[model samples]
Each structure stands twice: as structure tokens, then as C-alpha cells.
Target: MATLAAECDRFKIDVIGISEVRWNGTGEFTNQKGGVLMYSGMPDEQDPHIRGVAVYVRKNVKHSILCWKAISERIIVVRFRAKKFNMSLVQCYAPTEDSPLDQKEVFYSALERTLSEIPRTDVIILMSDFNAEITQSIELGSLFPHKTCHKVTWKSPAGNFESQIDHICISKRWSKVLCDVRNKRSADIDSDHYLVVAELKFNIPKHRYEHPQHTRRTYNTTKLNVGAVKNEMIERINNVSLMEDASIEETWLHIKTNLEEICKDTLGYRKNEQKEWLSANSWELIAQRRSLSRQIKKAVKSDKRNYYVELSMKAQAASEKGDMKELFKLTKQLGGISFQSSAPIENENGQLVFAKNEQAEVWKRHFEKTLNIIHNESGELTIPRHLNPNRQIDTRAPSVNEIRGVIISMKSGKAP
Candidate 1:
């Protein structure tokens, strides 16, 4: 298991799943690089030996365990948290020739029921050693033939033939594959059966709290008639009989190179379209949003004008009365009000009254509060009917837009 694990490590897999583990431990170990979020089955409290499935998460990834349940002697379901959303993972060790068919049916039924209860939206990855030979056949002589199933994951006692006993499967919602997927015999160490590893890149649902661990991706821009471009590429690939003669690597490499060339041409067409769009309307839209933002800023700045006016009056009166203490306080307050700058979050109400040097520690908090108030008092944030379920706002951005509308209505003659 350790040697096979090292082979897996070379692939830089985020998670490693083991079936028929016979351990109750969650499989968490600090030494595991990506923070192993492992869980093995021991559903029945009466049974002591784990005797089910287990997982190991790399120590680097942040995660939390949601739930773990053992459906049978071989099937286990484990749910865990990764960032904002919860993910469910199932590992099954189905009964083979040794175990009765009745047991397999019972276990599969329970497994099916357990899986059905889970909603389709959740990110799920189901894998296991389903000892049964999975057939790719359908009813009758099927016109739409199923892809041939390759069976060579488990080795026989004589070490001559390997059967497709070990397996990994996934749900339709989280359906992602790493191009070619097949059984790898190089990972067989001591566990009698060769470990089945498949490289899958899943597309998770877009959520506010969830973020990608991978680097930022740049999308390939499409041509003016994008659908036509895609069809053309498909046609070009079909023209070549590369698959029949060339190695899989060579065939895929040729396809990728052609794809890049086609995408590059499409990108050129896209750039021209963007230029035309800007020429037609984007400049005006940019000016409009900016103008509204400017109007909002101006209204906020004027509020501080009154504060400055009051402070000036106080300073003048104190100077005339020979009260240096009052004059200094007034001057400092006025000076504080004079200096303002942009911070992490843009201020909604232009009034960022700089605190005096003595009050520097509270500058950001005080300014933020003032900005929120200004935003609340003004009507700046509005969502149009066409833009329902808008993209998420930056956490640092002021969100008092909704409240500001109410404040404005009340301040104007419209309050009921």
C-alpha cells in the first residue's frame, strides 16, 4: 500500500481512496501533505474492525468531514466539506464469487437508496472495488452499441491474468475526465489487486465561498460565428484518419495542435468583434456608470463641507478669544477632515474624514462607517429586471445601495 501510495504521490492526486480498508479511522494524518480528509466505514457500533473504505486527503487542502456511514460490509458513504460547499464520496467493495449474489443485490440496493437521497447539485465522486464484472451490454442486439469495457485491474493468484475487479466511478453532475482513462498496473505493490487510478478534473458549481485551487485560466475567445468555427474544426479532425494508425499520444497531440491553430484564428475574429462593440456602445456605457459613480461621490463630499464650515467658525471664534487649546483642537479636526485617500474598499460617500494623528488607529473603521451611512442615505445601488441574480459583488465594496434608496425616499417628499 505504501509503495502504491508513492506512485500516486508522483501523479500529485488531491485525494486517495482505499476500499476494504478495515479501519474505522477518518484517515486523517498531519504528515499527509494536503490535509487528508479520510474516512473508513464502521457503521455498526457492535463491530470493532473498520472493514470498509477509507480516504486520505492531501494536508495542503482545507476541508471538514460532514458525515460517514457504512451501508454494508463493503459499501461506505462519506461526506466532507471543501471550502464553501459540501462534497460526498462513496466507496464500495461489492461481493464477488465467494460472497452470495443475494448479498451483492442487498448491498447494491442499499447503496442505490443512499445515493438517491443525495441531491444532484452536490459535488460527488463515487469509487470502489465492485468485485462484479460490469457489463457494457444493453437489451437485445443494440443498434447503439456500448463502448467496450476493459477489465484488467485485479491480478489472479498465479499473477498471470488480471480482472477488472477494482473500479472508480462518478456521478453525472460532477462528470469530468482527464481525456483518456484506463487501469494502471504499475501501482500494484502488496495488496494482491492492482490499484485503479483515473485522472478526473471535475467542474464544480460556481458558489460565492468556493474558489479554485488551480491558477487563473484565460478563456479562448470564439469567432464571430463561433458555432461555425467549432463545426469546421470538427470537420477538419474527421478528415484525418489519425486515430487508426497513430499512438494515442500522437493522435491527441496532433488534434491539440490543430485546435490551438483554430482557436487562434477564432481569437482574431473575436478581437475585431470586441473592437466593433466598443466602437458602438461600450465607451458610452463606461461613461454612464462612471458618471453615476461621480454623482454619488460629489453628494458625499458636500456633506463634509458643512462640517468644515462649522469647524472654521469655531477656530475663528477661539482665536479671537485667545483660547489656543480650542484653536488647536479645531485646526487638527479640520486638518484631519482635509486629508482622505482610497483604501482597500472604495468609499461610497466621498466623506473620508481623516482622523488626527492621535486617532490614526481608528481611521479606517470611522471612515468606513461614514461611507456606509452616506451610501444608505443615497440611492445608488439598483438592480434592473433584466439583470436578475447578478454576479456577486466584491466583499470590500460598499453594499448600502439598497438601504440608501429608502433613506432617499424618506428625505425627499415621498415617505408614507
Candidate 2:
């Protein structure tokens, strides 16, 4: 699986449809590198793993996946959000040509039904092992001519017989997007079939308007806790010269810029540290224990047990110390919890809004309709005249003392 992922990465493939997964049960899992693998196979209770199909999407492109359905062990379908038009991919491990006619008919009938269910506006791509040879077709045609080796998708063990059984077919409307389709013999998966790669000239449209993100530097303010650093900062501020005749704004800006420069020069930027639930020592112990377990030795077993006890002690110590962050992370890991990034939201028309500007527009429209109230009739509120007419309401501006009193009474740590 790792090798396959590496191959995909090498080729910079974002989406890959795999045939003959041969895994029991249908499910999905994020790999160590964050790539997602969605597979469909026979139920766990039913043994003797046979035909199966799957789709592997790169981590970067995982956000584009809208939904996926495991139709059967032989077929799976995944829908992806694309620019201009969405796309639906159907992966199949079709019955061999030599299989019974009934079986072949059932496979094709199911595929037909699946295709029918997909929206006609989608750019449908059907790929993987079809188990049939196509000499020529009017509706479907190969875009590029390659060497015979690059044309054959599968080969016999003896290296005598070879044919292009696997295929990647796209909707006629999107045929122009496909640049090339050929077999890649370099990808070695220890299978008789070679990897079939297809190139598509897809333009992932950006948001209509994107707010430019500016990276801000974070100074290590913690250094201020040190008496020397605090004194240095004060000394630098005292040494700064202010223009006596400059405007208030100009003077403030000069001081602000100088302070920032002094802090940057003295404190430097904070370094980001990658936090993990377990300590480095604990991870090292775990690696050593794993290495020892591979060897069949009584001494090694005893050492591994010792390492386990040490790891348990470390975890217990963390619990006693009330390290909530580490505890929660460890709990999630034990519970097999995986966190995924949020996907794009749908709009009023039930279509996904992927662009940031478009999403903002949708939100704007939603709030406008939700908050705006239309009143059929207006009612006037009548307040009785001031009860204490003799004590006239003060209409004069507040004095400096009154303003200072109000300022003193106000709470700190609040926005002005």
C-alpha cells in the first residue's frame, strides 16, 4: 500500500481508481501520509476475498470529494467537486470475458444503472479493469499513439501474451479535456496488470475574489519575563527620538514602528514546535520494544515488558499532572478517532459552493433574508412626560472630572 502511494505521488496523480482490491468489507481509511483510500469488498462474515474495487484520492484533493458509494464488491462510485462542472468516477472490476454470460450481463446492467443515476451535467469517468479488449470504437477513441508496450495494460506471466484490458473512459462532453491515456510500465505493484495513467488538462478555478493573506511575524514576548530583556526594551524605547512638531498620528506611528523593530531585534520570532501526545523518550521506548518483539528471545521479551511498564508509568504520570491536551489526544488515538477538514457547503440550488467569494455571497444572502423583518403595520410608543419636571435633565457636555470618573469606573481588557 505504501509503495502504491509512493508511485502515485511520484506521478503526481490526484485521483486513482483501483481494481481487484481483494479486501474484505467496505470502508475507508486515511493512510499515514493522509491520503484517503475508499474501498468496497465482500462483507466480513463472508470469507474468501474475491473481486473488489477502490478509489485512492490524494490528501490535497480529498477536499474535492463530495460523496462515494460502495455499490458492490465489483464496483464503486465517487463524486468530486470540479471547476465549471462536477465529476463522477466509476471504478469497476468487471467479470472476465470468459465468465458466464449471466454474470457479465449482471455487471453491465449494474454499471448502466449506476451511470443513469449520476447527473448528466457531470463529467463522468469510468476506469479500471474491464476484462475486455476493444479493437476500435466510434464513440470512444484513444487520444494519443504510444509504443506497443505503453498500449498493453496487462501481460501474461510468460511475457508472451499482452493486451489493453484496462481502460479509462470519459463522458463525450469532456473528451477534449483528456490529453493522453497510456500504460505506465514503471509502476511495479507485483501484479500482471501495468498501471494505466491518463492525463487531463483540468483548470481548477480559483475564487472570484480572494482576500490576500499576509503572514505576520510572532515575536517571543515570553522573553520579557527576564529582567535583562525588560530593561533592554525600556532602554531602547527611552533612546528613541520623537519629532516635537510632528502630528499625533505621525508620532504614534514612529514610536510603534520603533518598538516593533526593537522587539524583533531583541526577542526574535517564536519557533513553532510540533506537539505530540507521547514524549520523545516514550516514542523511543516504543520503537525499541517493537524491534525487540521481532526477535524470539526471553531476554528481549523481558526488556520489552519493562519498556511497556515504563510507558504505562509515563502515561499515568501525565494523567496525574492533569495534562488535558495530551490526555485528550491520547484518548482520541485510542478511540480510533480521525479528524478531517470541513468540506465546501451547498448553496440554495443544492450545488456546492467551493469558491471563497461565492461562499461569502451565499452567507450574505442568508443573513439578509434571515435578519431583515418586514412589518405590515407600525406602532408608535408613547412615553409619559418626565415625572420630575422640577429637576431638569442636564443638557451640558460632561466636565473633564466626570469623563475621568467614567473612564476609571469602566472595566479593563475590553475593546474601546
Candidate 3:
């Protein structure tokens, strides 16, 4: 997934649809590089992993996503908020023509229902493996003139036959925005199908309203451990001037300002430090492979193949030597998979809340309802005179010596 995302980034593509995901279940997650991958697969645990569909949107495009639905393993739809009219993308994995008629009917019936649910004003883009060849349709067909090689999307195992099974169809109302559609054969992902790319001449407008992001400044508090720094801070605080007849609030404001100024001058902000794990040699190999990937000649393909073999060997060697850190890093880089935090929580109406302020509001309402309970059956209890204690407890503040003893008994090197 990471490798595919990197390829999309290289081509400057904001969104891409994928078929045959084959992963179990349906959900969405963000990759380490910040790209969002929303996939739908077989919902049943007993079902075989097959015919899954997914859509990947780049980091910048993710903010515009309004909502998404996982209809089934072979169908998924994602809606995006756009400039004039919102855009809806439906990715599908249709059954082949040779499949049973009933199976094909089921797929088309579900697809029709999904399309009907979308608003008519939306500009829908239906894409991915349809497994059918049609010369005409309501959706705009590929009209750009290109070589036969650029039109073929899939090849037979023996490399004797080729076909264009994958396609990208846009609503006729907005068909003028589609500039061209072509197949890119140089993109090698160990699949018989080539990468189908579409060029659209349109702009995605900025969000309606953007919340200002406030970044909290973090000071290097460890500097306070230095004797000179500590002394300078204390001296600055002691030298602060205050009005003799100032109110309590005014005095507190003056002291707070002085303390903040002292801290800013003495302690600098902390910087985020990250380690570079890849060695120089690995980077060189990666660069060479990337350069070779752009060419479709036989010699370049052989060189790229050799590079993959070498990288695989290096990974095996690292595993044998028990260098788990390097092994894990290599695996993430080569296997095209990375870890993500988790999915966002849904609101009361089952809609996802992405903004921090909205999420806080949801939590606030939850706590208010949960913690404030009204009692329906309540009565005052009477105390029994026979159960009362015989001795009277003293109700006096502790003396200075007792307070000192209590403080001394507490453990050291801990926060109060």
C-alpha cells in the first residue's frame, strides 16, 4: 500500500482506485505517510478472501472527504466535497462475463441501488475492473487517441493476448473535464494489469472554513537543572517590580508575565529529533531502482528485477543476524505496508467527527448525561443513638510541629 501511494505521489495523483484488495472486513485507516486507505472486503469471517475493492486518497485530498460507504466486498463509494458540485467515486470489482448470470445480476442490482442513493447533482466517477467491453454507454468513454499499447490494461499469462478490462467513467454532465485516459505499463506491482491513469482538468476548491491550528510551545525544562540557569531565573523573579497598592489580580498578572519572560530567555524550545535508519547503500539502490522504473525497455526491466533480488537478500541477512530493527525498517520500506494509529470516533448520529472541537463537544455532552443522574426514590435516613461512638473527636488544626512531621514523612524525588 505504501509503495502504491508513493507511485501515486510520484505521478502527482490525488486519488486512485484499487480492486481485488482481498483483505477481510471493511474499514478505513491512515498510513504512516498520512495517505488514507478506505477498503471493503468480505464481511463474514467464514467467507474466502476475494474480490475486495478499495480507494486511496492522498493526504491533502483526505480533508475534503465528506463520507464513505462499504456496500460490499466488490463495491465501495467515497464522496468528496468539491468546488461547484460535490464528487462521488464508486469503485467496483464486477464479475467476469463468463461468471454465472445470477451472480452478475446480483452485482448490477446492488450497484444500481448504490447509485440511486447518491444525490443527482453529484458528479460521479465510476472506475476499476468492470470485466466487460462496451463500445457505448451513458458514461463518457475514453475519447483520447493513443497507441494500442497505451490502451491495453491487462495481459494474459503467456503474454500472447491483451485486453482493456479496467476503465474510468465519468458522468456525462461533467465529461468535458476529463482530458485523457491511458494505461501505464511501466508501473510494476507483480500484477498482470497495468496501472490505468486518468487526467482531469479541474480544480478542487479549498475548504469552506479552516480551523486555525494552535501549536503549543514546549520549553526545554531540563535546562533548569543547571545551577547557573536556576540562579539566573530566581534572580530575575526576585528583581521583578510590583505596584505597592496593586490588586491581587494585577499582582498575579505581573508575576506571571515575569516568570514567562524568564523561562523564555533561559530555556529554549525543544526540537523533535528523528533517527535516519536507512544506510547510504540502501538509498543508492533505491534511487537506481526508481530511475529504472521510468523506462520500459527490456534492459531496464532486468536491472530493476536484479535490484529487487539484492534488496530481498539484504533483508534475509538482517533477519539471520537478529538485527530486528533493521529488518523491521526494511520490511516496511519494501513490503509497501505501514502502521496507522486508528479510525476516528463516530458522533451520536453515526457520522464521523474529524474536528477536535466537535469531538470535545461530543465528549462533553456524554459526561453531562452520564454523571448527572436524577434519583426518583429517595428518603432521609435517621441515625440510631445506640450506634453512636462513645468518644468525641477533636476538631482543631494541626500545630506547626505536626505539619512539619507530616511533610518530612512524605517520600522524596516525587511531585507534590
- Which candidate's lDDT is highest? 3
Clash counts per candidate, in order, are 13, 0, 0
lDDT of 2 at 306: 82
How big is the RMSD of model 3?
36.3
The per-residue C-alpha lDDT of model 3 at residue 231 equals 95
Native-referenced Cα lDDT, model 1:
0.59
Prediction 1 TM-score vs. true: 0.40
lDDT of each: 0.59, 0.80, 0.82
Q: Ten residues in a row with the worst lDDT in model 2?
A: 380-389
C-alpha RMSD by candidate, in order: 32.3, 38.1, 36.3
Q: TM-score for each prediction?
A: 0.40, 0.49, 0.58
Question: How should the candidates be ordered by TM-score, best one leading?
Answer: 3, 2, 1
Error of 1 at 173 (Å): 4.5
Per-residue accuracy of model 2 over 1-416 as CA lDDT, tens digit each: 76677678888888899998899889998776678999999877467888989999987788788899999888999998887888899999999868999998888999999999999999999996988765432122366877776788888997657777899999998899999998877675568898999898875433243353555658999999999999998999899999899999999999999988999988988976645445678657654654564453567668877866765666677799987666655555455445453457788899987667999999899977666544444654333343333665688999999999989988654465
Q: Where in model 2 is the C-alpha error above 4 Å?
A: 134-141, 204-416
Estimate, for each residue in 1-416, the C-alpha lDDT of model 3 and write its tens digit: 75687678888889999999998899897876678999999998678988899999988778889999999998999999887888999999999978999999999999999999999999899997998754321222458888878987888997756777899998998999899999877674567899999998767764343553455778899999999998998898889998799999999998888878888899887775544455678657766765675653677669878877877888999999988877776776677544443345688898977657888898888877666444445644333444444656677988999989988998654465
- 1 against 2, candidate with superior TM-score: 2
Which is better, 1 or 3, measured by TM-score?
3
- What is the lDDT for 358 in model 1? 29
